[model samples]
Target: MSTSSGFSFPGRWRATFHQRDLAVFQRVADRHWPGAEPVLPRLSRSANHGLLWFGAAAGMAALGSSARSRRAALRGIASLAVASAAINTVGKGAVRRERPIVDLVPVMRQLKRQPFTTSFPSGHAASAAAFATGVALESKGWGAVVAPVAAAVAASRVYTGVHYPSDVVAGAALGIGAAFALRGVVPTRGQLPPPGRPPADAPALTAGEDLVVVVNRESGSATAAAAVIRDALPLASTVECAPADLPGCLEKAARQGKALGVCGGDGTVNMAAAVAATHGVPLAVFPGGTLNHFAYDLGIETVHDTVTALTSGDAVRVDLGRFRPGPQGPEGADGYFLNAFSLGVYPELVRTRERWAPRIGGWPAGVLAAFEALRGSRPLTAEVQGRERPLWLLFVGNGLFRRVGPAPGRRHNLADGLLDVRAVHGGRTPGLRLLAAAIAGPLTRSPVHAAVRRRKVRLSGLTPGTPYAYDGEVASSGTELTIDKLPEALTVYCPMPA
Candidate 1:
């Protein structure tokens, strides 16, 4: 038997199941309440162009304002994109099923722009499931809020006489699969390892015997974090320092300890790492900041992980980025960065975000600061390899960072002895080009953005006192600057890969 839409049922048990499922859902949809009849159709229509999901993602990015929320928002949108592609190209093409007829639903609830493609798997349901699952994987609180709306959107397809219950179910499964498949590429919170025997290669150390830990009190959750570290390594000497005193304290501690430990943000870690490097001591990093990017990359998520690594003597050698001012620049000045250094409006953006991060949080503050920087930023002229060029941004990473989706900022091989250098070329409308590059992501290749790998790079032709930032700390630079790699310069504790 075939429906009026020319959807012929195969002589198979699966076909019979699908037919029964559609009939049951059709009957239920026909008796929908008047309130829902009008409202559900409108809601389904609102989701027609993916506007509903996109708006939800934007809202998440704006309101949550943390690394986790931002990641959730990006992952949710990415999942929707993948789910839509799979449902439209593979799921729908594999079957010749047709959409449900309008007669199955109230006339007021029928969607005007009904999908014309085969409907064995509903695209709307797939996108909704994928987005919700992806978001929940990153942040349960936001995912909880999005769950009901995703469910409603999926059910709306059946209510508006566009998809059968079976079609929605298949699409949802496809979407969930897409989300799971993309997990390796997405940045999510690291899971804590179960307590067990330490790896044989772990470094053996007496608890707190020769360890000196410097904690930044200004960092978020510093007090609690310090207490956790103290409990885990009772003999370790813990020093609490104000933000201003962190560098000096770290240097002092580095001189006095067998192993130096740091519990703070990227900036604090950068300083402590320098001190440890200068003193030729291994370092232990604990995540005690708003966004512990370096520590996360190193697989150190908690104080327990640090304690385990310390006791086991598990450590890894990593590279450091060293920046030096030219002869025309500051006198006798050089510094190290573990993550990256940027010369462009990025410094300004960082300063602006720091001013507002306290009130609104990191991600939202970054969003606002980015808009302000893009709107008012001017092109900077620099001499790269002795060629004068107009540039918007110059980024130098200590090592090759992982390209996760559209962002390239996380490094997997910290010991790689190369600098990851990327630049944004100034064009007729450099600001607008920068915005386009941001939206297009790191995957899209254009003349506006260029990247390379090298051991060293030198830039000149900058105005005196131009600002540059390294590992989230912004400072003034001389007329000329040089960046080079310090391969395997630092030893740091990290968990063994499973």
Candidate 2:
């Protein structure tokens, strides 16, 4: 065999390998089973311009109907984009190998729009590997479903006589590498560190002096939780209040107690956090809500845990999210959230979920609400950072939320002095985009959504009566809204590390 480039030992070996690779391709293509003829041609056509993979991602997001599935689908799509770029631009450009001639391939199996680029690397193979790897990193189940299809797409490239076997192998490696490279650049849900230990200055709970516990009876688990708290801390004063009376009750308790304990869901805890912050008093949290997201993040899971922490004097100082009314709003109107503040379709989804949660259960209700929100909601137009844009949703968390799989719900540090801000950019078909995003996962590569860590965020250009949600409680906001982080704003009791 003769070398096109200057003769070298490695070049000689590569040329020999290419000869063997072509020989193997000839054998495989010439002896193809008749059964594969019908399937391979259609598969090759279906994958044209990557419409098949895009459709798969979108379908997964819509059918999976959960945050995790949506994220996985999005990650897969992003990986495909990266892989395609690398293979088409860098891999193919680096080598000028010609594609196999039509004589070498059976006439019946040839593609109509044969790729014109150098055949040293196959874009289809690269995209297939990258998408499969990316989805697997986000969700194993979704990855499993995608793997066979990806493999089929890669194999179809060779079966259709568009790429040599060696070219497909090289493309697969490039694609996998692209996926990993992209993963490093953009942190995924699994990349975030776990929640940090409690702050050193956190106050310790003491035995039996001016401890007031307020419980919201309206919470799903409040009645049972209140009973447990009463049994656990007999000396502490306990007050049961309706949802409407919670704020006033919390204020009165904050003034009377050296420490305040709240037993309810995120919304109830949010109210108590505001009162606790104002009074400069330590707070104790008992897991009494349906989801108990705040308490779980705080590492306090049960009444037993709260009692133990109170008796042992274990606690931590954490941040609070403060929301102030914007320029066109009422004076002195502000609020605080221990978890997050949400705008756009999320508030409506929450309300819809609440109505069905008791009957269908939380997960099912959430899925149903997601579909409803996607079907019925319109994008909101808001001014963010001085630019007016259409938005589907805006979420601001008290601290940086760690991405776990497809969801950015968990936090690594409660006192990070930063806000976890996320927003979905509105498009011509906002609902369709949202559905596609949910099926594919975060769509960060596309202009569909964005996530960032910041100290503050401002939004304006809202219709006078715009609705928003904070810690699961819905409320109306003015034309503008400002969310700021309050670092180390409140102290709360949590179980000591083992």
RMSD of every prediction: 6.6, 11.0
Give the TM-score of each candidate: 0.72, 0.59
Q: lDDT tens string, model 1, 1-498?
A: 335433565567666776698677768675746567767778787777688999999999767634677778988998889888887778777788867666767677777776787878888888899999999988898999999988888988888888888888888898888888778666465432322222233245668788989999988666779998888899999999999899789989988888899988899998998888888888889888877878877777677888888887888888888989621245666688988899888999999999999899888999999989878888789998799988889888877766565555456677778887878888777677776666554334577887778799988888988888888988887788889978788888777776
Q: Which stretches of candidate 2 lie over 4 Å from their true place?
A: 1-194, 197-209, 326-329, 357-364, 428-432, 435-445
Rate residue 191 of model 1 by lDDT: 39
Candidate 2 per-residue lDDT, tens place, 442-481, comes to 3243578777788888888888778898899888888778
Span of 10 residues, lowest total lDDT, candidate 1:
193-202
Report the poorest 10 consecutive residues by lDDT, candidate 2.
1-10
Those runs of model 1 whose alpha carbons end farther than 4 Å from true positions after fitting are 1-15, 18-77, 84-168, 180-203, 206-208, 326-330, 435-447
Clashes of 1: 6
Compare the candidates by TM-score and give the number of the best one: 1
